[model samples]
Target: MDLVLDAPERTRRIHRAAARFCAANGWAPLSEVPLPNGRRADILALLPDGSFRIIEVKSCARDFLTDRKWTEYRDFCDALLFAVDADFPQALLPEDVGLICAASMEDWALLRPPPAHPLAPARRRSMLLRYAMLAGLRASAAADPEAGLLARMALRLE
Candidate 1:
């Protein structure tokens, strides 16, 4: 029997595997990053070479088909990819973008490499700053749950 996970479970599993893949590859992965363009990237990673890679997570076919915003993420990163499970239909994804397939909750592999679309200098600088601020903010909040409400009102860089 095929084990069909629910949307949330699938997403969580994909996120865990994607984060691990990023770390092992020397990339810092940030989840649910709100971009300046008002797009919340599923995984926005800061590559070791100072470039960025945005990974959009697709829990299932409906998730991928309904979301067309992934196209807009190209302007903010050096490469864009979709992170999906082994069951996801690979053909539904665009060939130009990269692909990450999760074999299990703890395993992920980058199946396809993305073409380079270098970000404009100004945009890169801006994204770097925003990424830093958000990462720091999240770290602070996690380190101090008592400051939850206070941290929420600290700043809005997005």
Candidate 2:
């Protein structure tokens, strides 16, 4: 009999594997971070000293070559990582970014650092908070018209 896995179950397995891998490697990984431009990262990991890394995980039958948004995501992060379970040509990944692959926690690769700029923990935190607030504002506007109006009014008062 052929075995098949559901989407949620497969996602859970992949996430669990990633969490274990990160923990074992002494990296802290956070999932589902909201970005200012309405882009959300699947995982944001912090090195021991609090350096930031963004990881994007994909598990689809289709190839990554056709994904336009993935390229855009690489631009937003300091370091870009593509995590997958199946074998896909690493040549598709840009030379600058890193590639990580595995079926379980045992097999994972840490890609090299992004092009030199600067690594600042405080600056990253500031950026993160700003992104969070912007996302919150968007959510508020979507959920409550009164809140959105009040927010704009308060901003004008300031």
Candidate 3:
């Protein structure tokens, strides 16, 4: 019998596996990262060598088919990948993007490696700064849930 999980649950499982995979490969994975083009990536991984990878999680065929912003993410990272459940039809995914299949949070396998295209120096610098700032903000929020509100108030007072 095939087990089916809801979209949100499947996405959460994919993220957990992606995080573990990134850590094992010497990358720090950040979730829900805002991109310059006003897009938010599901997972953005920063490598030790200053490069980055973006992973978009697709829970099912409908999710993948309905998304039109995936193409825009290529300009923001050195590599791009799609994370999906094992039951997803992999053949439907783009050939250019990498593929990862995960049955659950503890089980994930890379089906294909993404082709690397290094970002321009200027873009890399800007993205690195953004990544650092976002990471810092997230850490702060974790410590103090009201940090965002406090920061906004401080900005207004300035």
Per-model CA lDDT versus the true structure: 0.89, 0.61, 0.86
lDDT of 3 by residue, 5-55 (tens): 678887888788888878878999999887888888999999999999999
| Tens-place lDDT digits, model 2, residues 1-158 | 93576655655556666666667779767667655456777776666755566666766445455565665554445667666664445556666666666576676555443443343666677656544554566578789978977885674311
Looking at candidate 1, the ten consecutive residues that score lowest on lDDT are 149-158
Candidate 1 all-Cα RMSD: 1.7
Q: Model 2: residues >4 Å from true position, as ranges?
A: 6-8, 61-63, 74-76, 111-123, 128-158
* Candidate 1: segments with Cα more than 4 A from true spot: 1-3, 146-149
Q: Candidate order by lDDT, highest to lowest? A: 1, 3, 2
| TM-scores for candidates 1 onward, in order | 0.92, 0.62, 0.90
Query: What value of lDDT does candidate 3 attain over all alpha carbons?
Result: 0.86
For all candidates, the clash counts are 0, 0, 0
Using lDDT as the yardstick, the better of models 1 and 2 is 1
